[model samples]
Target: MSDDSNAAGAVEHREVVVIGGGQAGLSMSWHLTARGIDHVVLERDTLAHEWRDSRWDNFTLVTPNWQCVLPGYPYSGTDPDGFMSRAEVYDWVRAYADMFGPPVREHVEVVSVTQSHGGGFDLETTAGPLRADQVVVAVGGYHVPTIPRFAEKLPHGIEQLHSAEYRNADALPDGGVLVVGTGQSGAQIAEDLHLEGRAVHLATGDAPRVARFYRGRDCVAWLQDMGHYDIPIQQQPGGLGKRENTNHYVTGRGGGRDIDLRRFATEGMSLYGRMVDIVDGTAVFEPTLTRSLDAADAVAESIKDSIDVHIARLGIDAPVEARYRPVWRPEREITELDLRAADIATVIWSVGFRTDYRWLRVGVFDGAGHPCHHRGVTDIAGLYFLGLPWLHTWGSGRFAAIARDAEHLGERIAAGAREKAAA
Candidate 1:
């Protein structure tokens, strides 16, 4: 090894540089440290700040506490049946870092990570430029919230915000609330506002495939125990791959929680079909799928009952049955002019998230903005990815699913570093 002054006389470099100090980055750090490897973690903010700051105040993890554990620590709270609040999860990640004392440089925003010659990287950050032999891109998938382009032209009275920006019911306008999208976040936000005594209107899209539980257990636990997380991204079988590929409709939160959308339905929750535009205060709905409304409501009832039973058995205090209003057809639709009306106040867009890799200048990403990795191994040598949805397999990037990929990637990087040193 060389002294700092001697090394500076040559060039600045770290052995391995892991980006994004969220759960995935920290998990990788844990494994790297366990193997006695030297590395540094560069974070855009203080560790777990995304969860601490970005998540809504009423937000609780969709997954149960038991399924929330990472590589080095288990969820150690007393409320196993209770869902973990975002603050709790953030604190847990911070504690994990403190206990392991991973070499994390906080507040160092990485502006760009460009590959240099000879399989190295020049990471340009807010602090300054630094070089590293290896880099791991661990920025999460849901960092950016997408709003429909048509929403921009809507009148000022109809407030528009993504689900990420929604904190609670009070964030909406004085009149009825319109929640666009049927994914987990959208449904939960709509339900929260309805319970808070707002006229809630949920705009329907393609409802995702949902399961009340997985294999007679909480869906999350079943995934963990079945080693869904252990399935290598390259080796994931067909079913889970399909499930992951499909949106799985609902949020990742399991049973025994309070995100009961059906309860809101029973309480006069108005529904609308597909949205075409927001002309005035109204979101125009499609008319094609009108015939299937009743059937969809039936399916929703079954889903709600199943959730109620699960929570009841576990003794969790979630409202099981509240009849919500259905605004549009269940099958298809042409358009409705409801959004242009002045009645709707807030529009919560709860659509899914997209991964962004533009900062990574390496040619490792496909056209769809996803990294090209076969089980977390990128095409660029010394560069890798972790905690990506379907990065390896169906369950590769779930809450409990991240540890295995972290371990594997850590080992591969260490081995590659050793081989390079020998060469």
Candidate 2:
């Protein structure tokens, strides 16, 4: 045991230390505790910091409540189909932390994580220093927000907020808001603005969407029943496995709101393809607005088709939803948005996030600066990662997936420990 860090120099040693207090770290803590591993969790903020602050006010879990299966603490709620609000999620996470009582050091920011001269790993935190025999990096992928270089070229009048920073429509100034990258964050933010009756433009891409409810069932339930989430990364269909990760257009609000760009277009929202460049004062966009819309439509329709076919084959009488066609939208490519003329005051960059491993002084990172680990185990002994997207299966980042992945990694850590003792 060691004392808490102070302003002065202080160093604490542990058998294992997990970085991040989100679902990943907490899961690791649970398994480690079960294995009697003398480990501590170092949290940068409160438990699930991103869920605590980074998410929007109206945010809800993209996955349904049933899938929120924490180790030894699964959701026993009656309404498994219902989505939990952001506040509810934060409280749930806090309660889960309290239940098992993971030795968590809160408000402790790890400035650097590197190999120690003696052995194992050394972490320099805001408090002081922490030494550990084994290190588990459980930080989720969305550590850094991705922004384009052309953003600098935009005029001073346009206020900017990354998806991480966006809270609600009330925060924005009283002009139109342009949302770039219509992924989950972008679509949700745009929906917020749209519902508020604020003029909004959605910069889109080849975004894919799945119906919230399919065949008289929750869309997630159908997928679970179909074993869609269990599909391995290599076995993913339609070359989905080839991509590192795709920002699928899924929303938790609006009763499983179908986030179609065309629907937004019909509802007085401007739908534009990718923001290509900001030349002079005008924001130029890609000429693939139709192509993006078609891609989104294809995903929506394909999911429905699969469900209809499956239910029919199983002889399960399920209600089918009417297929949605393209709504009224601009026929020509909306390649430019004159920020001044269009009264666009704010630009919410909801494109995506990048992994930041600069502080981690290890050779485990790939060229893209992502941790190079198979399923969670790194090449280096006593080093592992968790909460990464598609680390094992399509469900790798989800609630249930985290617990399973953590258990696997936790057993591996224990085996390594046993081997070390024998050596």
Candidate 3:
């Protein structure tokens, strides 16, 4: 779409502009295209670049193959339970674009998105400038790396990398690697490094864990049957604050393995409590190792009990015993892990991400830098967000669940377009 310009040269305009080319952006595009909405997708890199580059070599979706959901393209592969590697995920995203052929512009980095004096946005891009009547910021949550500032206290001799920058164990320097923040990425990366024979030190607080498979079916299978993904945003336990922190401990390797702090503590890897600070070239830690392990085990037991209850209610012939390895409860571990003394040369921070809204110059964002939206509708008429974690459900940020949210946002955008045209 092009607009007749007065002073800013010939400007390209469209009814809608989606800011990312990942699943969220593409899914939004598919919905917009289906409803005859004219829109463009701007990708700073190739499609699914973050999935291609941000994950490690052994990385796979925690959810199953059947959960590979999209607007029009559902998973048609044979093995629905199988997990996809990084390369395979890239292929899946590429195939989606080929099938839909959404209007996508690659390598066009959006430098800034300022509101025009008129309605809509003035987008300054690396490839020049354009404008759009509606803008959907589907850039996802992992736009920026969130490393603790205290990491700067470490001696330069100690190498450090965030989970986004870490590729594999071999890429790290020699000696033990201190992996901080034992969420999904941290737990997975620690396993990766430890499996690679690198001395591993996992520094973390109490993060809950769950057996990948419980009873006779996968844990996700039970979650799906119980309609876990369909739960509303407000009805969820822990309310809104816990929404940002409930990334569970699980992995997709070896037919969905059960992983937790206690399991890692017994794998010959040193486990420490939360890192407090660094003093005199020594990295200090909190004394919560036992507490962390016990807390994780309690959660795991609770999940297992829930699964058992469901199985009994359904009269399913699933096994009474857990199908995987028994959870390993190591002794009360060391509270302090001396980085230099332990010969730890590399520290991989698997401490989650922050939304990079630097390009957004809108007033709709909250004090936390999160957009204020009602199912992707920001207060500003033409601005929206998609692929946000817990935007609508627990699965909003994931590939298996983005399509539903995208479809909702797409309809919203289309309605806005119709209103503009009618006016």
Candidate 4:
């Protein structure tokens, strides 16, 4: 811990330190305390501020309430069918932190965690410095919005911002709105806007199979009931084994947790296949592919139901039986939104988000701008990472999946601490 920095003098020392105060950071803090380890959590803001601040007003956990619990605590709430709202989840996280009374140094921004001469770390923060024998970086992946470059060429009046910044469709410019990307955020936003009586156009890139709930039942309950939550990741077989580490896929960054895009279509949302170019505020789609995508949605839904069946047979739970729902596709004679024909006020880009680790001057990041690690262990001794998407297992990085990684990493940290103390 450093008392003063940039004064030509600073005190620095700590046995262990965890960077971030979200689920992973809070999880690690609990485990460290369980082992009687002295550590502190350095948070850039109050706990779960991102959940409280960034999420849209109507956003709900795609994973049900049963899956929202953290280690050393259970989610005690009355809403079983009621998907947790953003505020509800944030409150749960804060309560969990307060329960164990983890020492959190809030509002202190960590600039970097450079390796010191002694091989530990010179933790440069806005407030002084902190030296640690071990450090766990739990900064999650949803920090920055990943915006496509093509959007830059659009006219100035056509407003656009990523999903992280979008609160709801009320912020959009008046007219039929054009929503690009068909992943979780895009689909949800398109659905919400269409329901509000706006003429919405969804530009889908690639449509993936999404379950209304995992396996015809609530996905989270199945994970816990079948021990998917506790399954030893090394035992995953076949495609499951291949996808044990989830960072390989380039599809919708948010999968398994978004509303069914097909649902939006069934509910009267206009959908387009692809955006070729924006000509005077009009987005033109490829005619052939545009015609084929609507029919393709049926195949996608079938594939999703198949996965649900498989997941249910894994002994997770009985499969859910529901009415067959169809995908939302744009008609050839669909009504086009003329931003030029009318007033265009705002554009909410429900595209996706990315991780911004540039501030942390560390050597562990890969060329793709992602942290390089094996099971959350970095090559830099004493430096660990957590809550990364698919860090070591299929579920490694998802909110419903992080506890497994947290437990394994916690054991590793605790054993290492014991070894160092014995020395």
Q: Please name the candidate that would achieve the greatest TM-score relative to the true structure.
A: 3
Off by over 4 Å in 1: 1-11, 209-217, 222-263, 288-334, 340-342
Which digits, one per residue and each the tens of the lDDT, describe model 3 over residues 1-423? 754534466887877889999988999999998998888999999888887888888998888989889998999988899888788889998999999799999999999998889888999999888889999998887778888888889977999889888888878878999999888889989888878998888887667888787776788889888888888687878766645775878899766787765666667888888887877778788878777777777788887888878888988888778333445654555655667888989988887778779789889878988788877788898999898888878888787678889888877887898898899
Q: After superposing candidate 3, which stretches have Cα over 4 Å from the reference?
A: 3-8, 322-333
After TM-score superposition, the amount by which residue 283's alpha carbon in candidate 1 deviates from its true location, in angstroms, is 1.7
Clashes of 1: 34
lDDT for model 3, on a 0 to 1 scale?
A: 0.83
> Against the hidden true structure, what lDDT does model 1 obtain?
0.70
lDDT scores in order: 0.70, 0.83, 0.83, 0.68
RMSD in angstroms, candidate 3?
Answer: 2.0
Model 1: worst 10 consecutive residues (lDDT sum): 239-248
lDDT of 1 by residue, 1-423 (tens): 114415544555777889989999999999988887777888987888888777777677766777676787888889875677777788888898888898999999888988887778988888777788888888866767878889887776668788888887776658877788776677767766766888888776655434445334555554454455566545544632443353434443333433334445556786667676866544677752343244445654565455556666667664334454544323334366555453876778887677677788889876676667777788788899887777766555567667877988988988988998899
**Cα error of candidate 3 at position 216, Å:** 0.9
Which tens-of-lDDT digit does each residue in 215-258 have in candidate 2?
Answer: 67877788788888777666776443443555577778855656
Q: What digit string (tens of lDDT, one per residue) describes model 4 on residues 45-69? A: 9887888888777766666565665
